[model samples]
Target: MDLTGKVAIVTGSGRGLGLAYARELAAAGAKVVVNDVDAATAEAAAKEITDAGGTAVAEVAAVGRTEAAEALVARAVDEFGRLDVLVTNAGVLRDKVLWKMSDDDFDTVIDVHLRGTFTCARAAVRRMREQGEGGRLILIGSPAGQRGNFGQTNYSAAKAGIVGFARTWAMELERANITVNAVIPVAATAMTETIPALKPYVDALRAGEPMPPFARTALAFGTPEDAAGLVAFLASDAASGVTGQAIGIGGDRLSLWSHPQQVVAAYADGGWRPGAIAEAWPTTVGAQLQTVGENLPEPPAA
Candidate 1:
């Protein structure tokens, strides 16, 4: 996983999983561009890496907009001479059910997670193509996006769109030798604190308690650093042939998620009428109805 002499960018790297990723990449010998919406935190993050004998610089940008995305790529070029990896980790969450989700809530999440990914990848790919060197575009995805989650309509859509980007770009950039993959990370960050089931575990960790094995193994929840390892591995040459995958990682678990595929299919001889379809539904597709949401195991008795 030696990234020596490579230049990389990690957006929203002021803290949380993004911070862990930037630090790991820098530690692996990559010159990192740490980007965040908060100027103070961004500078602080960059300094922390530099003070640790790693090369890093801060770039403050909101992400999502073409101008901000382009500026991040430009910063890497200006400071490190070339861009080798881009981790689109910047995002916001707006949780609400369909009935109660306002337009603003929907738009905010979409702008940050979905559109932000598109713009940043566009800018990064262009630069990577110009350099004519193979590169890595690691996009962050969520379990909420993989399987529908309650009260997260906006967030789910945006994250799903991110994975969609990875699949599409993998095909589009194959000739360019640029690999695209979506990382589905589970960690105890401020983001996960919002999930009711994970809150107690998150709070316990904040109070200096060890994370329970059940949460680590069963829920696949752990520290941000637990998930950071996967991001660094995907960025390295070791994963050069791995592309268009939605890989999950956390505490004690690593998984490969399959793209949408039909488990079973039924056909009608002459395009059956509505009455015939209604009669056959229960015995056909309805009988194999797929489950939604994460299939979590029952926790050990307290």
Candidate 2:
């Protein structure tokens, strides 16, 4: 899709998935503001895009903070004249079991992943509304949030909260022609490296060796570039009709996730009582309750 004359701000674009998104958007003809906490990495990413004949500027600011988030959107407007796309991809991982997780760990994750998206979207949408041109708000989500992972209580909660933001904002912004969507990407970034089960595949990729079929599938699905195309598409005009949706992208796979809904309903003449609920629970909604772990089938051997 052509994004000529458009401007975009991508948080945490110094490396990995954010960088990929920034680069791809730039390649598609958008001026990009690359935001990251690290000055050097942000500058390097912006320079790389410029070197490749694309327009980009680096903004070294940590997201989640109100001032920082506002600054990022302002930078895009100040440099490029208008803000058209906002990609909230900045995140940090502080993994621990629910009981073992510290207050700082929980707060920090939520601040970066959830609050960062909220603040940035708020800042960008204001500009989009003032400019009287529709815009895109693309928030990053995770597989862990969709299907809970072990020892990621804080991370999972933060990622899951982002979906709620997208859904609500889509409704509020639709009248203005703005679209809000969440992307759950499986990419082989530093974040995915934390998973012990994926180490062998990551190692094989790094060493440039041929991997077994299963490992190859896993590695391909985790490639950062594989997710970038979807972000670029969402930023374009073609996706104007797509909003309030959680889209998944991994390698050759693209899927739409189902929204939360009631699976079964049981009603009484007046209201459900504790005793009545107890009697109907097993055969009603309770019957479909999934087992948390071990009951699921294992992956094929490599």
Candidate 3:
């Protein structure tokens, strides 16, 4: 996991998972650019790294904006000479059911989580191509994205879109030796605190106590530091062959998620008509249609 001489830009690095990623990268010897919308927090994170004898610089920018995304990459190159890793971790949550979710809520979440990752990756890829040294593009994803959440249509869609970006970009940049991957982290962070069921676990983490059984088994809740370790590995040279993967990190568990595939394909001599499809679907594709939220148990007695 030696990242000596490598330069990395981690968006939304002022706190939580992003900050953890930045710190880990810096600790691994990468010159990190800590980008956040909040100027003070970004500066504080950078100072923390520098004070610990690691190289870092703070960049305050809204990552959803193309100019800001470009500027972040530029700052990394200007300050560190070359960029090697780009972790698009900047995001915001706007949770609501489909009917209650407003246009603003949906648009803002998509812009920050989906478009923001695109813009930053676009900027970084340009520089990476020019340098011809290849690089790592690590995007953050969530379980809500993989398996739809009850009241997070916007967040789920945006996170799922990021996985698409990783898969597509992995192929597009493979020739250049740049790897693209997504990490779906389940951790006790500010974001997870929004879930009522996770409050006890988050509180326990804050108080340095053992996690609740439900939290440990169901969410597999861990700290941001646990997720950071995975990101650091992805950024390292050892992970050169691992790309387009949706990796899960929580507590001491790490998982490799399966990509979508045609489980059952039905063919006919002639193109199947609607009637034919109707008859075949039930026996074939329909039978395999998995249940959603199967992993979640019914609510405990109140």
Candidate 4:
């Protein structure tokens, strides 16, 4: 994806997955906007890119803030002339069961993951339309949203919203030649580190519990660079035909078909109902009992 003169903005690029995306894009020749809430960290990340022989500038602003989003867009335009890609990678994890989770916890997670994505994309899309050149928008989602995890109600809800946002926005932006999509990443990031309570699940996998066929596949995990590769392709012109889709990236397992299959099987006899679902529990339990080696991947070391 030779992005020679293109401009790309990656939020939360100060470190971790966002940093990997920025570096990879820069290596592919895009001038980058490294945005983070912490000014010092953002600037340092920019310097890292610059030192590595890539054109980059840092923007310190909270992405959930509309004003900050505008400022971020302005900085990108000022530094690189025009924007070509926007990766809404900034997010936070406020894990708690629905009952125990404080209202503030839920609000904060939503504000950053969903609202921050909205703020940045809203500003970038306008600029993209004005530039008369199509652009790419990639929203980062998570596996927890696809398959609910315990104590992550807030995070899961926000992540799920990104999928819907991409689907709807893809239609609205198609006429403008801009493609919108979501990437569901399950890499061992800071957020995944909090899942230590899943040790039992891990042990069950190792001990060969009755698990779904997909369970065995879940044992594998991907690295940040592994995820960056997909994001790079999505942001490139090569992915022009792909829109309103969600791609999952993990070690050796893309999981592109599993969701569709599950949805189809779920509706085999028309749609779902509470009674039908309840009736299926026994069958579901039986299936799980036959499965093996299904374990959540260990979180990356903090």
Candidate 5:
């Protein structure tokens, strides 16, 4: 997983899982460009890496816009002289139940998560193509995207879209040798601490307490650092042939997620009527109906 000369840009990386990914990539020897909307945190993240003896620089910009994406890629090339990886980890949560959600709420989440991933990948891929070396595009996804979650319509859509981008880009960029993949990660960070099921563990982590095996193994929930190694591995040369996959990592768990594919189908010889489909449903496709939503067992007793 040596990345001695590879240069990377990780957006929304001032804190949380993004920071962990940036630090791990730097530890793997990649010169990192840490981008965040907040100027202070961006600089601080870069400083922290530098203090730890890793090469890094800070770039402050909101990641949704194409201009910001272009600037980020430009800064990476100008600073480190080449761009080899782009981790689109920046996101926001404007969640509400579908009926209660406003347009701005939906738009804000989409602009940051979906549009940000799109524009950044576009800019980075162009540069990688010009450089003529294979590159990695690590798009961040969530379990909500894999299985819908209540009050997270916007977030789930955007994350699901990110994984879609990975699959499509993997095909389009294959000849260019740019491998694209989506990471479905679950970790306790600012983004997840407010989740009711995770708050206790988040609190415990802050108090420097150890996480229970149940939290780490069953819930796949742990500190942000737990998920960082996956990002580092995917960003390195070792994951060169691994593309077009939705890989999950968190806590003590590492998993491979299956894409949404039909498990069963029913066909009519001459396009059956609705009545005929209804009659067949009980014994056919409906019998294998899939489940939805993230369902976690209660955290082990306090």
Candidate 6:
């Protein structure tokens, strides 16, 4: 659908990847609602879009709260008279292994990433259904959701939930002409920068060292604009036939099949266990360690 007269609400648009999406959508002629927890940041983002000759407005709201989600959606429809696109991109990271992860950490991540998506999508879907004009819901997910990562149990679970939520919503919204899809992106953003364990691996890769064999088929890093392009396409009518699917956008690596494909068979209750870990044996564990050792470059000595 042409966004010339449409409106879009992009959560977390105050900065980073969300900002990229907001800018792109606005440039495409959509009246963009830039939502962020920080009022100043949201205002700045909206101003940037306006400066670039695009229509935009700033809203400060905690997307994780249902009321805030509803208010944000209402603001879009109230200000622009209609809402056409809902991009649920707000996310936070609280990395910790299951053993060491606190209950709060797990709850916070799930609440913001998964529950926040639920709240926003729910509100938007209701409005879209009422208007009978259909709509687009683009969810931002991560590779961690596809393949479990160490020291990121909370994050992985939250991201995985987004994938499942999108797939289900796609089916429910199909008959209504509303399309739901997941945009799996791999950009170097604030979240990645805070991952200490990933630093060594990233540094090694930058130094020309080959990545691990089980590196989950990582795509080369791309600028935020690259991800924005994919989001724009997915939000457009060009992808009308594409629904209930997960489209991944990673530099040159579009397909991510680098994880142990048989992880499910090794699990007992659809969850990881110590015994299951033993069964992985020489194949999974060995492959991972070998890859890390082979690819990890030593730091410069003082």
- The reply for model 2, stretches above 4 Å from the true place, is 210-220, 291-299
Please report how far candidate 5 places residue 302 from its true position, in Å: 7.0
Q: Estimate candidate 2's alpha-carbon lDDT, on a 0 to 1 scale.
A: 0.88
Q: Which stretches of model 5 miss by more than 4 angstroms?
A: 300-302
Note the residue pairs that clash in candidate 3.
none
- Put down candidate 2 lDDT per residue, 122-194, tens digits, no spaces: 9999999999989999999987878788999988888889998989999999999999999999766788878
- In model 3, what is the error at residue 7, expressed in angstroms? 0.5
Q: Candidate 5, overall lDDT? A: 0.94
Ordered by lDDT, highest first, the candidates read: 1, 5, 3, 2, 4, 6
lDDT of 1 by residue, 222-297 (tens): 9999998898899999999999999999999999999999987778998889998899999997789999998877
The Cα error of candidate 4 at residue 298, in Å, is 10
Which is superior by lDDT, 5 or 6?
Answer: 5
lDDT per model, in order? 0.94, 0.88, 0.90, 0.81, 0.94, 0.80
The residue-by-residue lDDT of candidate 5 on 77-192, one tens digit each, is: 99989999999999999879999999999999999999999999999999999999889999999998999888999999999999999999999999999999999999988878
In candidate 1, list every pair of residues with a backbone clash: none
Q: Which stretches of candidate 3 lie over 4 Å from their true place?
A: 212-218, 268-281, 297-302
RMSD of 5: 1.0
- What are the per-model numbers of colliding residue pairs? 0, 1, 0, 3, 0, 1
Which run of 10 residues does model 5 get worst, by summed lDDT?
293-302
With a 3 Å backbone cut-off (N, CA, C), the pairs that clash in candidate 6 are: 1-237
lDDT comparison, 3 vs 4, better candidate: 3
Span of 10 residues, lowest total lDDT, candidate 3: 291-300
